[model samples]
Target: MTGKNMKNDIVNKKDLKQLVIRFYGKLREDKILGHFFNHVTPVNWNEHIKMMYGFWENVLFFTGDYSGDPMRKHVAIHKKHPFSLSDFTHWNKLFIETVDEMYKGENAEIIKQRAQSISTIMQIKLFK
Candidate 1:
């Protein structure tokens, strides 16, 4: 792939869905983050994953399918368990790892960048 043609490497909805599923699969077994999804909130994985698919699709492709207050949701979760900067750091790290493992394109880079930005914003809002 050449630098000039890199912009053409767009991510489709199927790829986004796979990324969401695979990332959550890792999160479910992750030592640091697993408890939040498996025990703390006891997530309904089907519903959550479906929502995430929509969310990421909207975020990456501008599909406009997601329509919930993610910040509010995270704030409520934080109130219950108090996430620290390390948590955000770890989350972003795992996210980047997941994206890198699956893709190498403009959309992949954009996704990682957006995840980092979102993690930073969440940390500021929840911790400070």
Candidate 2:
């Protein structure tokens, strides 16, 4: 099925991989947030995508295949460029939109909720 049609179709490793890759594709092009990935460090797309796959898999499925200090990384990035509340809002919007467009189910809801929670914590930590 087409990627959009895949929404709510199924949740699994392969589908989660697609969701992450597709989401990042849109995220990297976003006007408000694009610079972070595109200009901040000149992202290694393959590596980033791989790491994201592991992250989402672990988050959604408890795969235990991902490990990293996301908060510390964001803190460093915030020190460098400073993400604002608006940036986090835009990120949440994109994250929800991406997840809703690609999947809809328990795991899909969990992803969106987790994104919201992550954004909330990041905002508090970065701006507090």
Candidate 3:
């Protein structure tokens, strides 16, 4: 469906969950990024998905629903298998595409911007 046909901003937790699930679905299937989640670190998807829902919810709405040091987790993963710039770039690309495909308006735009900013920060921290 086109953006015109699907005109709904990510307004609440339900929307956030849908976006997270869909975005991670793509991430799991992604060639470059998938290995990190599926092999490198081997995420427990059930818990991870719930964590991400809270993460994005807090990110967009400041709901204080999530609490975890994402950087620390990534740092540990980096020690196990170093992440390159392309990993972050592809992550941002997939995130933006997923958001664009599923949402629009203020929240959608903010989430994309935040995802990009977060990706950039992660690259700097991990690659530095």
Best-performing candidate as measured by lDDT:
3
Query: What would the TM-scores of all predictions be?
Result: 0.89, 0.90, 0.93
Name the runs in model 1 displaced over 4 angstroms: 1-10
Error of 3 at 108 (Å): 0.5
Alpha-carbon error at 64 in model 2, in Å? 4.0
- Estimate, for each residue in 61-118, the C-alpha lDDT of model 2 and write its tens digit: 8884789999998988888899888988888988888888777788888878877987
> In candidate 3, what are the lDDT values of residues 41-101, reduced to their tens digit?
9999888898888898888999846889999999999999998887787788888888888
lDDT of 1 by residue, 10-122 (tens): 35887888889999999988999999998777899999899988888877887857899999988888888878788788999899988877777889989888878877888
**Residue 38 CA displacement from its true place in model 2, Å:** 1.2
Query: Predictions ranked by lDDT, top down?
Result: 3, 2, 1
The per-residue C-alpha lDDT of model 1 at residue 107 equals: 93
Q: Could you tell me which 10 consecutive residues in candidate 2 have the lowest summed lDDT?
A: 2-11
**What range of 10 consecutive residues in model 3 has the weakest lDDT sum?**
1-10
Q: RMSD, each candidate, Å?
A: 3.8, 2.5, 2.0
Candidate 3, residue 15: how far the Cα is off, in Å: 0.8
